[model samples]
Target: RKFWALARTGQGTTLRGNDQVNGYLLLATSCDGTLATTATPTTVRVVCNNTLTIALDGTTRAIKVPHNTRFDPQAVKKQLGIAVSQWDTFMHRMRTLSERKVQWHEAMGFFMSVVCDVPPNSKLPEVLPNERALRKVQSLYEGGGRGATLESAQGTAWGLLNAVTEYVDHERRARSTEYRMDSAWFGQGAFIKQRALQAALQLAA
Candidate 1:
């Protein structure tokens, strides 16, 4: 069960409802009298015939690996963490905009801009999983990753931050409009009145 959950991150092949699922592929192999290397492009299912018991973080949680499993569990964990963190940061920035009633499309536009810059060839393999493959996975993420060149990485980080700042500005302007409208229409709500008064105080400061 633990293996199945963790394996989801590396799994690309999917099963459609009322459809079939392709079995795993053999991504690596070893032969006698020859140096061991990664598997060639083949249709063989990558399976772990040997059992490996690994304690994930020394907690009760552990991974059970059957033989013929070529994928590295540790590498998978690291990449998953990186990928999740990237999404988390993006979502957090978006949340700030939402709290201030900023347009949802604007937040999505910011995310799309960063996503567009990722190199196409930088994509990872669909089947075989390894450290190199994991690095490729991290590259897909907008946040920092091992594959980031010093130039590209710094630029991307700065771009995302700038987008956040722009969103904040739009949010403030949008709030000001709403506050003005509320005063002109309902002519109520002490909260709005107080907010306007505070804005005046801050502007004077």
Candidate 2:
């Protein structure tokens, strides 16, 4: 089962680039134990239909209950109540990131840090960044991505972060559309986006 609750304001927030987006509280679960029951706060970009889960605090994005455990609607709703109250705080952070400008070199480094894969204990001299992915994301950030030219995104950490999300959500290669959606929301793409968010936040800081 899946559910969505729109923000109480009923109006989209204007991000730094003049982009407008609506925030939502998402609740998803599966009876067959295929998926964990989770309550997550997410935002949907109106321009490109891209989504990014909001990190309520510095790190926590969602509250989850393993399928093995009995599903408790009241408990989940209680957690979501707290998360919903923090929407303003999360938007504040996003606005701060948008106001933080990023140079081309800094953006490149941020993207590399996000897309490059190096084993924690590997002894390799240097692991090459995913050149294909790098180029695509770079192009997106440099006005090729959706909403890239918006005031909030142009030359800002928020824009760079959105670029990564756009790639993962719309441009990344997948076996099929369903597969892409699945990955974007619940698989490797999700991890990439979370990493991108953290990297961008660090840059903004």
Candidate 2 collision pairs: 16-152, 17-151, 17-152
Candidate 2 residue lDDT tens string, 33-125: 777777678888888878888884457568899978887889877887787777788788888888999887788778777876543334433
lDDT of 1 at 66: 31
Model 2: lowest-lDDT 10 consecutive positions? 2-11
- TM-scores, all candidates, are 0.18, 0.85
Best by lDDT: 2
Clash count of each predicted structure: 15, 3
RMSD of each: 24.8, 3.6
The window of 10 residues in a row where model 1 has the poorest summed lDDT is 42-51
**Which TM-score value belongs to model 2?**
0.85
